[model samples]
Target: MNDKLDLQSTDITAMNIDKIAVLFPNCVTETAEGKKIDFDLLKQELSTEIVEGNKERYRLEWPGKREAIVTANIPTTKTLRPVREDSVDFDTTENIYIEGDNLEVLKLLQESYLNKIKMIYIDPPYNTGNDFVYKDNFAKSGGEELFESGQIDEENRKLSPNPKTDGRYHSDWLSNIYPVLKLSRNLLKDDGVIFISIDDNEVHNLRKICDEIFGESNFIGCITWKHTQQSKNDERFLSRQSNYNLVYSKNILITKNFKFNRTEEDNKNYSNPDDDPKGFWRSGDVRSPNLRQTLKFQIIAPNGNIINPPDNGWRWSEEVLKNKIQSKEIIFKNDNSGIIRKIYLSEQEGRTPENLWDGNVFGTTRIANSELKELFGDNVPFDTPKPTGLIQKMAELFRTENDFTVVDFYSGSATTAHAVMKLNAEDDGNRKYIMVQLPEASDEKTEAYKAGYKNICEIGKERIRRASNKIKEEKIDKAKKDGLFSEFKDEQDYGFRVYRLDSSNMQDVYYKPQDYNQGTLDLFADNVKEGRTAEDLLTQIMLDWGLPLSLPIERKTISGKEVYSVAGDSLYCCFDDGIDEAFAKEIAKEKPLRIVFRDKGFKDDTAKENVKQLLKQLSAGSEMKVL
Candidate 1:
């Protein structure tokens, strides 16, 4: 089986491989050692589509492009380790903060999050010469270097700064970004969209890859945002004042249509001046820019004067205009120049978010910096954190429903998390956010380190805490003023569960199960590694079973031993030592949809054999699993 999928998920790659094998049986031969796919044979089979020997086909080439390709496909025995101390509300919250290499996190998320994410937004390094990029060397993981990036050998594992002085400056950045994006695409829902914030440094390069990965047809509009108003006098050429969000949908056809969340400012345009019982009303343009000779008709003014069609003619036909006039839905200008149509506020769903955004609507960089200083007691740690307002706009644009998941692999100062909370408070949305940030060490000389923030992840988590509290206080004031205290509940989650990508709780022998036998297992005694708790093992199992880690957990003593129930008995688990058969039988009585047990926790073969049979009989159709 491909490592990405649990028994629950259908591995698309595997499915495709099977489909290909059905058409060409000879191309399905396995490698001599590992039963891996023979890509050479597959390429030979698909000779028509295959381009080789310096053909004139267009392709995006970089020094390390092949290595990046290999990086995403390489398998790992890694798992997410629960860090309850670092978390705010570890058990009850839906939001999660993952501290690790994003590439690995992307891999781990494949099964549980596949076709589940509603939207994604990331602001990655822009290849600004001094910026650092992740280098994934597959050879270091003991696999043959199937791909090559001229930068590294099979030894080192570290992030290096891609200096502009290097010959392969752009190539290095492409190598860094390509694989992560390819892997991230697997997690997106069919209608899911991704918004990447980038500047001139890598916007063109990013766009090229996005077009390739998401397909040119699925490309959404590139939104240009005015990030700042002040001119940088130090620039030698034209001063940079804006950034862009390259948007793309996983599959555009599934979206039905694009929409932006209706904002208060958008609704404020309507007023009930001469209300005809349609609530608040605003004038809609009756004339469109589309030319249609059929729609070019004259209309009689309220004063019985003739009014001519607009430059491009009318948006409605003469019949529709006559019906509007009869229904009292048309408004005439007091100056007797033109007529307008009524657009009732109650009928409006949302306005289309235009491609251009000014600084005033979404707060500028200056405002973001000021916000940081205020939250951090005058200590501005991050250099160019985006304003929450800006990210909120993007979130609202892609959010077609009230509840959805948003993942940000490059969550710098947790501004995106702040935006999620703010939007939720404003509209009572149940949006969940997942923030992944590498624990990039903070510079010792910087104010962040001086303020006791040891790494970027620390600063980001702290920002979320501060932002959450501030939003809560503001909401309390609003509720008090509106006299809606009784209607509001204080139970909403403003906290997150935290997990770190760490080595698996299982020993090396467990991953390399082929090397171990029944006698070897006796010699090893305990399969789980030392210094790992039952909870840690439980978390790894949860992920392996394709269960979400954010589900609420309930621990109880059944038959005088510990057992865990997740999300109200949807899944049951017990990883305790010397677990009794009676306890297993008791758990099976609940008949949860899924159940898990430690493979070695049983007293002996008889104990294990008895419960295995009892569980099968007691809980038919349940997904029974063992660690």
Candidate 2:
């Protein structure tokens, strides 16, 4: 039998069980689904004390917690189909835009993007009663009310509003987000970080789950973003003008320091008053942040005047302080009142990000609305859009690399894509982005719907296109105005490849051949779906092989058969019918690292054996697979 493609998302649950089996074989037991982790045995192995039945533990629990966990581990048969008509650059662009349920999208990305993303930013439903929350099947027990409420999409995705009156309001919201977040965690690099925006409605519950998911030690900090200076005086009590941004890292040890790009204002305090050879310097506080008895000793100035340490003590140790004085880093005031530590501008890495972000610096909701108004004109399409500045600031705080990858699952209005392009245009970097959004229908009465934008995904895709054009035009205008048009050729990527999640390209018989008897074998001649194209098969094959969907694809005809070359020989695919020895030899001569073919494409059994032997002789290292 030829090698068949395993067309499904990664089996994360099985992988985890295997990992545990290596460490604790006794904790791994057989179940109906093969090998599974025995939680009772695992607990006993992890704890020093005796583990009993139904023991109480500290955890964030809801009605459907177990279901939520199970949902995250279950692999999906879904695949991402490329949409060339909706895409900006279908073949060459490294960026991606997927229209689908983010939970399924995240699961599909586990193998291809595991530990690869540099940053992630999400603005999920705040569960503010009015906002619609994702109504996962496991998130709620019954679906009659949801169906009657008329919130299910054409694809059967439930989108129900979580009113405060509902008894399972909090529990439903928890179940909805828990699985998506769990899957998202697997895609982050060791030094990667995720920033989630929320409001007062569910911030408490959000933090509890985040602490449980990312671990308490990995909790970075919560930023209080003052979105609007004006207060809502009509509120029952005090006005709520700010929202919270909860930041977390994949590994705290890998990414401990978060900083933002230093601005002109940030560097204004630094000056070369004494013309120090090191460079412009600013006075830094010598006091320690926490109490340290060993660093509380007094220091003798060069003039023999004793200088007392601050209340908490010095920032550096006595030996380090002596080194600093010798290096002239610590200087005494002319009045001998206190010591001033000279922090050189040249030595400063970047401005340390603050927990409190002001509206003027970050962005306000009003600013975000204005941005949408400018892009879409009088009839804005989306509501509650986040300004590009806010997302850009998060990337800067993470100290994003020039070629870093950013993902936004809840990509409302595609602001994250807009920000990535904006940052690249400003710095001439080649950053990439992936924006995944659900195709939630727009209300008929809404202006967006009236403007022919049928769903939220339409608005998001149009937003990115409009934003990309605007950014490119602005860059050209500035370059021309400054008389540097010829030399100012920006090579940054301002395009994205569009993909929509759908059912696998393969037919049922391809996955379950054992179920079909010899009598029904003739019906399964063509394993692929009827409407599927060559590109669709190649895309799914790439995903099944753990290849990124954004990789460059080149198509060419060899020996009268159309073949796809992915990333220039990283992978070669030929789903065409009628494969023969000549075609196989022609393909193998290219020395492709991996090759795939259609099993039924060969002329006969003898022909298939000849092609296989030819490939082995021509390209010994090329891994061959069949569909």
Candidate 3:
């Protein structure tokens, strides 16, 4: 009787089919499942220079490649249920923390966050044989050892080992990350970027896969981050002290130039010794970097001393050099030996970011361990956690926008969240973070479990909480020391909303309505699952409606019926029973842009039709949907 809400994640396969149908309508045909692309016919249509029949091509592939692709395209009925009890500032915070499998979580986010994220930074598993635990069809038959060892469970959602003894050691890791990367690409804006951390063991393979996913042309160079300075004497050859962060942009043409904020150390070279109009200037080389005959010239100083050009050439031509000298941009030494070009501090943008990062600027592993120790008091929650400074530096490279979003799927210890908050507090920028981490269980014998942290998500959430307080205390201490305590305004967001991925709220009968008969209707009266709260249904509805979960929500009573208003009437929802024409008319007077209701709320068919017609007449532009 009413338009039902599509309570499912975005169907990527359908979208691909629609795209193909637009280009090749003749190759699209209706099937029992739905509209499907006729691949054979489509291939024939593009047969001009098309490779087929196992022709060799440049690609990174492995077993189950097709299955991985299918996994990315498949739609999910799963949804993120709000966990307000575990969240901080649940009603107002823009930051989010989701606990779930990254792959499924990425699928659920396809619609609401498509092309919305400004940047992504993930330190995924380096796959040193024992780190891989993602269970998928990539090595189903070869996981006998893992199955016998009790690594995999009935739901296939637990951590399963991908041992090196297995034949598909690298293949399993590839398959696990491939679909996640594909789904992540959809969430990046046109000018967005992603930084992936890896080690020597899988850096080569990671780069190849990233090149394929983000396009070879969009490769933005990898940074070798030195995480430690100490050398291990027990190494087989040499002690490795550095890892890599492969950078890529969604589109290279629109990506901004990477740079870091200029620090006090970077500006120490500039001075106003000459007291020129420019604030501060540093001497720059006036010689050309490469040989050029036209630039080879001589210049006369104010003391009638002619100085010969450098071996290669002068940086500027004769006339240009004369103009620069006239403008006093070029000056001679006290002895009139050579000319010096003045590089003013005011003219510089920032320090150019290098491919090699080291020292405390990027934070060492020792410092990271110490940071955890300081927060947790010797009982460190995680081993080898990344430093907040490291992620902060990576975020600084994005000099374009300040009010951007950063996502970290492998948010071990929530370092990315802490870094974002720290950066925001430092500069008063509006940067938000979305952390997605699988709740890998902590061993009972480990310190984390002894500290009452049952899983990785628990550690991540607690870290964020403690880090938030620590950052706030530091800010307060600095403000008081500077005698600016009263004037200081802490605008940084030190809170995040928590959501856990779970099965859909809809019952099995909701998806299979045709399977029920008139006699079976009594057993399946309510389509929604039992114990699902109104907030749970609202969350799913927002996702299905392609609305962000960060929007403001308020509950109000209109004509004795509770109505939920989102973002000031951008959406309105009421799942209560006993809805009649009076409530519909009253809610329609609010003129909501979108509204929803429970179909069973209506008393009879006539009442449902009457309420629907009244809403249409009152709220002409409002879209009405039902659950």
The top-ranked prediction according to TM-score is: 2
* Per-prediction backbone clash count: 0, 0, 0
TM-score of each: 0.80, 0.86, 0.85
For 1-627, candidate 2 gives per-residue lDDT tens digits of 339998999989778877898999877654423455779889999899998966668876667788899989999998988899999878779999999889888988998898999899999988878775656443454555544444764345567777764646777788889999999999999988999999988899899999988888999999999999898989999899999999999999988488777889999998988888999999988899999998899988767888888889999999998888789898778877778899899988888988999999899999999988989999999888998999888887656467889999999899999989998888877788999998877888889989998888999999989998899899999999999998987777777898999998888754365677876777678778899888888888888888888889999899988899999989999888789888888898899999998888888888889988999999999988888
Candidate 3: tens digits of C-alpha lDDT, residues 1-627 = 349998999979878877897999888754424356767778879888764545557887667678889989999989999999999998889899999888888988988899999899999987887666767433355455554444553344346676654546767788888899999999999999999989987788889999999999999999999999898899999899999999999999998888787989999999999899978999999888999988877778888998988888988889889899889999888899888899999999888988999956799989888888888998998975998899998888887568999999999899999989988888888999999997777777889989999888999999999999999999999999999999988877888999999999988754366777876777567888899999999999999989888888889999888888989989999998888888888898899999988878787778788888998899998988889
User: After superposition, which runs of candidate 1 have C-alpha atoms over 4 Å from their true positions?
Assistant: 1-54, 136-156, 256-288, 292-313, 316-346, 398-400, 477-488, 510-523
Clashes by residue pair, model 2? none
Pairs that collide in candidate 3 are none
Off by over 4 Å in 3: 1-56, 136-150, 153-158, 297-311, 334-336, 484-491, 510-519
CA lDDT, every model vs. true structure: 0.81, 0.86, 0.86
What is the C-alpha lDDT profile of model 1 across 1-627, one tens digit per residue? 237745576757667766876887666533212123456667766687764544445766556667789988997679988888988977779999999888888988888798998889999988887765646433344333321332342234545676754545777678779988998898899989899989898898899898888898999889899999999999999888999999999998886466786778889888988857879998888886788888788888878889999988888888988888788788788877888789998887778778888889987999889889888977788877989999888777754576988899999999889899988888888999999998777777889989998888999999999988998888888888999977977655788988988888887754376877778877467778889887888888878877877788888888877888888878888877676677768887788888887778887778887888888888886777777
- Let me know the TM-score candidate 3 reaches against the reference structure: 0.85
Q: What is the Cα-based lDDT of residue 409 in candidate 1?
A: 98
Per-residue lDDT value at 82 in model 2: 86
Residue 298 accuracy (lDDT) in model 1: 89
lDDT for model 3: 0.86
